[model samples]
Structure formats: structure tokens, C-alpha cells
Target: MLTPRARPARAAGGAPRGPPPAAAALAPQPAGADSPAAAADGSPARADSPATAADGSTLVRTGAGWIRGESTEEGRQFLGIPYARQPVGDLRWKEPRPPKPWDGVRQAGAFGNRCVQSASWDPGYEKPSHTEDCLSLNVYVPDGHTAQRPVMVWLHGGGLTAGAGEDIVPDTFARRTGTVVVTVNYRLGAMGFLATKGADGLDGEASDGVSGNYGLLDQQAALRWVRANIGRFGGDADRVTIAGESAGGRSVCTLIASPTARGLYRAGIVESGAYGDCAGRERERATGDGAAFVKKAGCPDPRTALACLRAKPAKDILAAQAGFDWGPVVGGAFLPVQPKEAYENAGAARVPVLNGANSDEGSLFAFSRYDGQGKPLTAGQYPQALTDAYGPELGGRVLTAYPLTEHASPTHAYGATVGDRSFACPALRLNTALADRGPVYAYEFADRTSPPFASLRELDTDFDFGATHVNEVQYLFKHFGLATPLNAEQRALSRQMLQYWGSFIRDGVPRADGGPTAPDQRTRPGQVLSLRTASAGGTAISTTVGDEHRCDLWDAVPAG
Candidate 1:
């Protein structure tokens, strides 16, 4: 069913609300070419390929039922494994329940459903095929690896409202890096972030009567599943790297700060989205009020709110999502304060981190706001907008640093400057602040520009959304199914990225076999790897991108 953006237009207590009838129209269907089937033991067939071993025939065990996956030139793929149980019926809005043990082998050939989201915002030209029962993950293991390999767990980004594990295919990285790649799906939108008033009468407690953070809890559950079952797939559970982009990146930061997430992973890779504290107490309280509003609409008894939510049709739950204000909350047992406070106070999980951002982070959001309809805003207008959004002093500093006059167009300068301060710079600050505690590898995706989506390219002409927010994902995962296909140079860069990422997962630092070479050396003091393509070849340019940009200034900015 079609739904609007997840954020609500009205606040709680303003009016009565109910689930939309459109939600009931949604029906469960098999995802893609793979479907769940019973194995010889009457359990779900596993997706692991029997021919995936060095001898071209091996069986791997997993938490769920097992079967053989396809072995191809790319790599061996295992799809549709349930990392957690289906969050349906009585389990709705509660802590993730463990997947029920099956009596026999079950088939896991297909990917589980992606968390429910608005179809409008999905950028890869694909749509969500499944709903709330979407807590599954996919794994890619290289064919030649005999011993347990390093693992990289990837989290996708879609503003906490959209995105799925199916969006990324880690085959290329798996083949090139010889590491196990696991991409996961968790609760999103209202199902994940909506916090309701607890039966204990505590106003700000989590919706599940614990600390609210079901989405984060879902991610932790997947990590636990990985720690328990990854070894069977030739992966080293002890050496794990948690990585993400945009909202996924934000999640990486959140995971580092969450006490429940401690010891689950060894390292982190945060791309684009890394704000110190994206959600605050007021925001969390607002989310709770939104949930209460939903409960009042459906049932009079507060004790059975969860039961009522489960009995309500999926469409109704999704439709009611429009009325709910959702995001992370602070002052709860799980997360006592915002992420920034936790990090600055040294209350976060201490681990090596790899962080960076695109040059045109703001263009994506700007393009979305302008509707690709009118001319881009002017340079003067850019500062005016910042002042409107933030306050005066901060807006003035932002405009001075990223003067619009320097660029060919106001939109270009505005996007570059604001995007850096709001998204990119904060990420750099996170790395710098945490560097002394552990190793930090920083980079900037300075690819001149990305091939534009046909529809969006026509709207903003002057500004070349250089390596916009999610552009690096296809390169990182080597899977462009949801994105445009990569060119030869792009493919080469993907290989380099895979090497850097895999090496990091293997060790704390991201160094390749030959060690830091001249042109594309690893990140060091005063060195920021620039991912650019030259006539000779695509290589890393050691230009002080991070230092020159004054990323250190973030250290002084008080944690929000």
C-alpha cells in the first residue's frame, strides 16, 4: 500500500487517528526468484550451496534451516536466513523474539521482506516486496577461503524510514577481499522507532516497557546471530566490522554508544551520516506521545495496546505511521543521553573507526526539497536558509567558510558548504575525537561527479552532485542492482575499496598487502585519501582534504 513520508505533519494530542484501510490491501508474496520451501527433513531449505567448498561441494550450517546456494564466477551466496524471528502478532513493538526452532531442514533461498516503507523515497528504482516479517540477512563468502575469514556486516541507509538488506549485494567485495560479507534488515519507520507510554506509567520509557530502540535492538540481534552462526559459513565471529552509510552510518554511531551493543563487533565504518546526536529527549517524548495517540485510536484498554497493534492489519499499522513521530530517544536505560554526550564522556564502545563523506551531501536533500522543479537557490539565499534552520551566529560562520561567490552557481557552493558542516564535517570530528583512543582511517569521495539518474539529472544542471550521499555504496559493495551500473574505472575503484575495507576488518588498521604505496597510500597523519580517477589509473590522491577543511573545529562544538 502507498504511504506518505513516515514523519507526521501534526503533533500528538491534536486529534483522533486510526489505521488507513489501504494497509489491509497489502498481502504477503514470495520475494524475488527465491521462495521458502521444506527440505528433506520437512524444515525450511537452506540457501547455502553444497558446491561452495574448494572441492565445489560442501554444506554449511546456520541458525535457521540450511540448503545449498548458487556458486558462480562472482562468489557463493546464501540468502534469506532469518537472523531474528518475525516481529508479527503479539511480538509487534516489543523486543525482538528469537526465531522459532524448526523440526526439520528449511529452505532459505530467497531474501526476507524489507521493512515496510514509503515506495516514493526508494532511490534504486526498486520497491519493497515484504513487510514486518522482514528480519532476514544475506551472506557472501569467497570460494577459495579454507579457514575462518574476516567478516564485514553492512547496514543500509534511508533516513531511518527506507532502505533494506536487499538493496546491497556484497558478491564483488566477497570475491575480491576473500572475506565474508553479511547485509542485514531491521525494523524501520513506526515499527522500529515509535515509542509509546509504558504500563508502569513512566512517560519516557521505551515502547516495549524497556528502553525504546527496537530498530537498534534488531541490529544487535543480527550481530548476535552473526557471532553465533557466522563461523559455520567460514567467517571469524571474533573479528567483525560493523559498517553503514547515511542512516546506516548514524546507526553505526548509535551502536558504538549503546551499552547493549558492546562486544558485538570490533570496528566501525561510518559513511556520510554521522551527527553527534540526531535524537534528543524532547524528540523521544514526542515519539512516545505519537504511539499513545495510536493506542487511543484502536483500543480503550492501555494494557492490550500491543495486542491491538498486532491484530490491526499491516496497512492500518503503516497508515497510522503517518500520525506517529519516530526516532531515537535519550535518558532511557539503553541510551542514557544523546550519542554525542556518550562519546564525549567516554561512555561509548572503544573501537577502531573508518569514517568519511561525499562532497555533495546536501544536494540530495536539497534536490528532494526543491522537487527538481525550480531554479536552485542563490548563495545569499543559502546562508539565509541556514540562519532560518540553525541560528544567526552559526549560519554566518557557515556562509563565510563556504562563500557562494567561489562556485559557478549558488546551488553548487551551498550544497558543498552546508553538506560538509551538517553531515561530512561531523563525521570527520567523530574520527578525530576517537583517533587517540584507537586507529581511525578517514577518506573523502572526491569523484568529480557521479552519472546522474536520468530523471534527476535534468532538474539541477549547474551543480554536479559530486559523489552525492549514497553514490559510494555501489563501489563499496560492488553490487549496483539498485543503483546505476558502474563503469570500468568505477569497478577498479570498487576493488580498491573492497581491499581497504576487508583489510580493516582483518586488522584494526586498513592496510593492503604491499603496505602504503606512493600514489594511493593508506590514511596517515595529515593525509586524507582522495578517491579520484586519473588518466594513468584510478588511485588515491594524498591531499589534506580533512585538515584543510578544518574538521578539528568540531572538537570545540559542544555535544548536543
Candidate 2:
């Protein structure tokens, strides 16, 4: 249910990519509701409506070329702009290449197709239809943002199997925070993560060439594109921050560890997808899956495997890609080691980190037959689930620490137990590692009564959603309309959260004007922000989240 983040005691940029550039500026607007853009072809959009007019198309120039954008109330939005070459034909399974320079202005009024993946979260956010050629990004520069405003790059989450950049509208963040935002859609599922030996003119024994982690590389390409051209859109290239949740969060973690991602951004925010120690086996297993897929696609021969796989229907290849482990693989050139190892060795990009998880993270995986109204499951149910998940020894310890009577139901008890050991504590563990290395800030979003995105409510069953895995997102951004409308107190919390994040992007530290100060682990060990609502009493500055989550117990449980 929960994603993850890295942490360290309170404290505080990496390599520069591409060639150097000249200074840039924003042309002042006429200072009115209705105004004209300064430059028609290559000038920055009017701070009010720089490139676009009321109810008309806006245009902005990227490093590659000029593109027209769609207009919104807060600012002009450039949607479905390709950052890299379409990953189709021979490009499939290969590292992303730069978009072939365009001859003329491209129309970016609508979103490109979403990368091929499984079904999206029905009713949560409207994702585009699936296609193999779906490597695009969207940019939203708020009306009043200056040339020096912080740029927030967003990656959507669906456990690396689904989601697209268009899923979340950038209007809320741009309007609320006055920040330039870019959301990207990378390759997903088998199309993105499949690994194979002797594909792409390389072999298992060959030295580092292209990685199987193409999704990660696609994200890198987006960042690089931003580095080279975001200034044209009024973004400060030096002040970029990468942010995401769930599988998107996992992307953030891997990016921090990726050598290619060095100097790409100044900060990172991982909501819940940053747990679990890395293993060297993901590459091998994914490689095996690729081999199986090639055979199943009628391309067992190494010579034509890639070609045949590329020629197959997207759905057919994805059907073959489903059964394997589809996340990032360690022991590849991009990783060289596990993400945890990279962070601990100070091998990651040493940017200021803001990482945390929700209070009730694991309930989403609730057994369908069982309801989750916080009801206690049968005594035997919780224990057996534990024993089945972990052998009897660890299972008994889990049961003793969390007996059925302590919860509303056996389902809830089991969920709570798995949540603590699996999501919450592991995240805290990551924060501890981060704190040891640099300035880190941690938080626990505990506003349980808040409504999820309208689409997420489609998932409601007999069980209560609580402040589960994705609930915190509503307090931060619209999350592509995945969140419900906020009440007054929840609205205040949302404002506070935005202020904190804005401050972090602007100043690399999460602090509020009159609110609680989130502390660094070195100066204030074990302190984390309790992002609750005034309705839930009041937001906390120093919540004992580690203690409540029973991190000590999880620390003792052996790693699988």
C-alpha cells in the first residue's frame, strides 16, 4: 500500500550534461488578464500567457524545435511533446535516442498514447490508450513564474506496469506552488523492462552496452532534455527536482543510483516506492523472461529474436512480458550494484532528499474475499497468512507482536502487520541510511479520513481505505484527478504541504512559515513530520513514527 523514501539527519547537485548555454530572460507581460506573448516563434510565453492566448494555442521552443501548446486558465500547457525518438521499429528494446529534429512546429495539443502496459486504475485518472511509441512528456509553466523558478519533473506510478504523465494534470502544482512542472511517460511493463542476452547486438557476456532497464533510461532522457531546453520554458535548469510516488518513487530511487542520472537534478522526493534492499538477480530473471518471450513469440533463434518481438502486436508482447519480475535490475551497467548499496556507499547523487510513507500502507493488497473495515480477522487467519508469507518462525513472532484482538479484524491485523514490516519500517530504514549520508527530511502522512482520487474510490470494497498507501497524494497535488475534493481542514493541510514542498524545491529544505519545522536526523534523530489535518487534531512536527511502526521489531527480522 505504501511507497518509500530515503532519510538522513537534517543537512542539504551533481554533474552537468550537454553543452554550456548563454543566459536567458523572460519578456515582461502587459500586466493584465488578457495579454500578448513577447515572441511569436522562440520567445518565452507571456508570464501571463506568454505563448498562448485566451482559449487558443500557445507555442514554446524546446532545444529540438518549436511546438504549439494547449491553453488552460493557470498557464499554457504543451502536451504529448516527444522528448526522445519513438521507441518503435528498430528502436524497440534499445536505449532511447534523441527525437529526430523536427522540420517545423509540432502540434502538442493532446497527450500521446500511454506506453503499453496493463489496464490503468479505472476511474482514477484518464490515461491515454496504449502504444509502443509512447515516449513523450508534458510541460506546464504557470502564468506568473519567472525564469528562475524551480522545475519539478514528475513520473507517474503503477508499480512499473501502468500509468502515464498525462494521468495527473499539472495545473494544481503550477498554480499552487508557482513552479514549472514537467510530467513524462516512459516505456512500461515488458516493453520497458525486458532484459535479454544477445539482443540489440549485445550479449550477456558483453560489457555494458544498452541496459535492460530502458524505462529508467527513458526517464534519464527526459531529464537530459529538460537540462538542455527547459530554460526556454522559463525553468531554471540548475534547480530541477525529480519527484514521484509508488513505482514512480522506485524510478526516483534508481535515478539517484544511476551514473547517467548524475547532475540531472538538485533534489529527490520519494513518497512510498523506495523500500527493499536490492539484489543482483533482477537482471537474470528478467533476461530469462525475455528469452521465454522470444521463444513464445516464435523467435527462439537469437539472430531474429529482437526483430520478431518488435513485429509482434504490443498486446501480444506484453502478454508474454507479464509473468516476470518487471522492476529495475541490479548488476547491470546502469546500476552496477543494488540501489541501497549505491546510497550507502555515497555513490548516489547527493541531493537533498525528502522521503516518507503513509501510516496504513499494506491494506491495498487485502484479500478480495475479506473486508477491510479495520475488523479483526479470525485469530487463525492472521497467523496463517503470516506463516504462509514467512515461515512459521517469523510468522509466530509477527502474530505475537500483533495479536488479532488488537485490531478490528483478522484482515486488518494481517494487513497492519505486513504493512509495518514490509512498507513502513523498510522506508524508515532507507531514511536512516540517507540521514547517515546527508541532510534528510522524513514525514508520515496520517490523514486517514481523507478521500482518495475519485477514480481510486472505484476500489472501495467492504474494507476501509484509511490513510493507506496513496492517500497522501491528495494532500499534495490533484494527482491527475485521482483524489477527491478536500474539506476545509484538509485544504489547509494541502496548503501547508505545498508550502513545504515549494520551500524544498526553492531552498532544498522542507519548512513552513509558522508551522512545525521538519528536522534533520543528525541534529534531531528519529523526528519526522506527522502530516495530519487540524480535523485530526493538528499536524505534528515531531511524531514518533519509528516507534509506532515497530521499526525495532522489523529491524530484527531477517532479510529475505
Candidate 3:
């Protein structure tokens, strides 16, 4: 029942232009050969280059070539390593291919260019990017690691249009969790998700003239890369976990339903990402969107649309897709059915899932629509706001259930309604759907006092963000390439969260030594873990999540 609409670019960065220079052709080495002679086989060792430099930089050899990364007190970080060939020119909308082997050592000290996107609040990515050589991933390996550790592959969330792997530096998290972390960058916007039906020219990427979902395919290719090469970095490829926030979180669920993604990951962690009832766009809708996009991009003829669109500049495609929604397309081999159907029918990957949302999941969205635009909602406008968001009939019932008298302001009431209907209820429903198929753990981040990311702080609005969307990301990792320093109490909560997530990634189950026991949804039914600071009663088990979030009322509301 999820409908596609123009997705907002909520994150930031500058737009970079042009394609990356082709890699110098080099003979491929045997995969996973780590001998000293192998290092000598590629390029002569630099007089100043040492395995461990005084600046803590180190050189690590991957299957394709040799690369150097920097070291920190916590771990060694390899940034901007290409996972796939640049999706440019003839391969614009095609499926990702294995990266071409490169000669000599590829300096991985800096992150590669982010996928072309318009700017927003994301710190390092505030400028728009025009580069297509963005299919890269960053690796974080804890220092002095002896054995193969569990691996966590992170996907950044920007409504599938913005953000990159550099959004969060996970060296500290990798060290604390004792796991290998890999953050990835995939195609975004029109270059990533444009699908046109009857476009035979695009059939090379998929069967039956299918198109779109290139971004999702890029992610799969990254996972394949991890499976093939993670062992060389001291990671257990078989124990990989896929986790993300918002759009990335939705991708986690979609991948669970993808037949092609089976065995790529052992488990998934969803953070405030169960929007649209955890469903994918239908094929007809996706094709309609794509066809419209094709016409707008000056490629109206389906017979020649693929070639025309691919010939257009990447910037032109980005401009033409300004007001379109981009996401996975159902009815293809990549995604045969809606994710909701997959979970209900037990067709999804049978793996453990840890899913949850924040306490005020809708506050940020409401603020953006109201106060963030300098037009705070008034008491008189509350009814109309609900009617606009939901239909008049459903809005009336929602208004009656959440009156202004019960909230601090009109925005608060609207936020509560949006949060329950969009995030909280959907997550609860997904937990129940997956519980019967496999172990399921649920949680609600209740630390309302959590600090906003640097971008939000710069917004300089009086809107109380509470534990809104993307707020919990800071407790687990550095957000938007900047660290949100935590207070003593918040630090404790961060440690506890790391414990829960680390345990889930390392083992199939989520376990924390002294924290509250996270009960499986199958056994606990309506119960969930409430993540908070010690002064706020600390992290503990809660049996009132459904009632508090008003899932009972939302369950009966119309999905569309």
C-alpha cells in the first residue's frame, strides 16, 4: 500500500563534477595473497612509506591491489575503496560490475566523491556532487585484531537521494564493539532508480525490459565484495550484519525480501526506518514514474529512451528528477514482491532482526514542515493539518484521539500522530510479522534529551527535536562526519547501545551484560526495550510500547 512520492533531500554536501580517471591496467593478483613478496610484486616500497608510520598510517593489500589507509588509536581505516566499476556512460543505469584491477598502490587516505546529489544539512556533503565514480566502501578494523571478527556493513540514509559512507566514522565503534565495520556508497537519485517499461535498450541490466533499482543492486554488489574479500581484513564474511537508518533501514528490510541477497548477510538492524508499512513500490507505479522521468529528460520514446537518457549529462538527469520518488521496484527478479508480503508469507530471509523507532520519531518531520519553515502551527490550524496529512475521515478520528489539550502545542500533537502512523506502528507490525519466522527484538529509543547533529544545531530553531528521526544514529556512531560529544549519562546510554548492537552483530541474539534483558518479540508480544540514560531509569524492558505509541488505533487506519 505504500505510494511513491517526491522524496525530500534531508542530508547535505557540495556537488562535484566529472567522471573519475580510468584505473591503470594491472595484472590481477591471486585473491587474498598476503605475502611480503606480494607487496613487492606491485610497486617498490617508498623510502618514507612503512607498514606502520609515525602518523599511524598503514598499508593493507586487498585482492585487486595494494592500498594504504590511516590508523587511529582505536583502529585502522581504509577509506574510499572502490567496490564496483564506475556506473557511467553506457553503464549509467546498468547493474554494477566488479571494479577493474588497478596498478601500484591506491591511496585510500581520503573518501571518494559522494554520489551526485543536491546539498542539505549533512556536514561534509553540504555541496552537490556530480561524480558517478561513487560506488565505494570504507573499512574499519580494530587494532591488534587476532581472529576473524564479526562484520557490520552500514548503509547511509538520505531518503535514498543523499548521504555517503563518510557520514559516520566508525573507528571508535569498531574498536568498542570488537567488530569490523564497512560503510558503503551506492547510486542515488535518478541515476540510481530510474525505471522505464518496454525500454528494451535497458534490458541488459535486468530481464524482461525491467529497469531501476540500480542503487539496490549496487548495495548487493558491495555485499558480494565483502563476502569475497572481508576474510583478508580479518572479518568473518559469513557473520556479516546489514544495518542502516531511515532510507538505509528500509533497504535492510528490502534486502531481507530479495532472493538475490540471501546468504549475503546473517542479520539486520532497522533504526526508525519502517515507513510506508515496510512495502516496496509496485511495478506499474515504478514504470509510470520512470516513463514520466524519461519524458522530462527529453527521452520520451521508449525504444530510444535508454540511450538518450544515458547520453544526457548526469546533472541534467538530476534536474529532471527533482520532484520524483526513487526506491526499489517490485515485480522483478531483484524484488519479486512487496516487502510486507514477503515477511507475512515467510518468503523473506530467515535471519534474526532487531527493529525499532524513536519515542518522538515524527517531531523532526513536523518541525521541518511547520516551525523549520518559520510557520509554526497554531491551535486553530491543527485540524486542517491533520486533514491534509491524513484524509478528512481518518483525520477526524486522529484529531479526536490526540486533542491539542493533551499536547504542548499543535505541532506536538501532529508529530505524535505522524510518528505513530508512519514509524512506530509500522515497526511494531514488522516485528510481529518477522517474529513467527525468526527471532525478533524490538526497542524504542526514549532518550528525548538526545543532542541534535551539527546540521540540526545549525538550523537554530526553537523546535524541540526530542528523540526524533536520525537522532539515535549519534548514540551508535559519529553522525554526518562530525562527532556529537555526549554527557556522562548520554555516554552511558551510548555504551549500552553499542553493547546491544555489537552483541546482535556478533551473535544472532542481542545481549548486554548488565543492561535490561532484550526479550524476543515472539515471546514478549507487545513488549520492547526502552533505551534511556541511568537518570531516566536507564535502559529497561517495557510492556507499554504499543499502547504508548497508539498502535492499536493506527492498526485500523487505512494504509494509503
The models' CA-based lDDT, in order, is 0.63, 0.70, 0.79
Q: For model 2, what is the alpha-carbon lDDT of residue 117?
A: 68
lDDT value, candidate 3, whole model: 0.79
Winning candidate number (TM-score): 3
Instruction: Indicate the worst ten consecutive residues by lDDT in candidate 3.
Output: 1-10
Superpose all Cα atoms of candidate 3 onto the true structure and report the RMSD in Å to 1 decimal: 5.0
- Put down candidate 1 lDDT per residue, 1-560, tens digits, no spaces: 01112111111111212311222121132322233343333455345532223333333445553444545566667666778878887677777877865433234445556687765534342443336878878877787757578899988777677767756667767777778888899888777876656644322333435334788889999999989988877888898999988788888888887787889999998887575434444544754565565665575465666566668876666666665555566655567767776777888888988877776666665655442557567655777876774579866776776676666566666556556666766766676556645666777776655654333443435546667767777676533233346677765666667677777788767664323432212235445666664443455645566654545553455432
Q: Which lDDT tens digits does candidate 2 get at residues 1-560?
A: 22211111110001111211111112344422223333455454454433422223365656565566655666767777789998888788788899875534566656666688665444422333347767889888777535667899999887677777865665677767878889999988777777777533322433222357888889999999999878767788899999988778778878888777889999988888655643334666657766786787677877666667778888788667656667776665677777778888988788888888888876665533255344445765666778988789988877788777777677767777767876788777777777766778888888887775444465545466567777777677655443357888888888888888888888899987557877776677678888888867677766578888778888897543
Candidate order by decreasing TM-score: 3, 2, 1
TM-score of each: 0.80, 0.86, 0.90
List residue ranges in candidate 1 displaced over 4 A.
1-59, 121-130, 199-210, 276-305, 323-325, 379-383, 452-463, 479-488, 513-527, 535-560
Most lDDT-accurate candidate:
3
Model 3 C-alpha lDDT per residue in residues 450-509, reported as the tens digit of each score: 986566776677678788888898898867545677899998899989999999999878
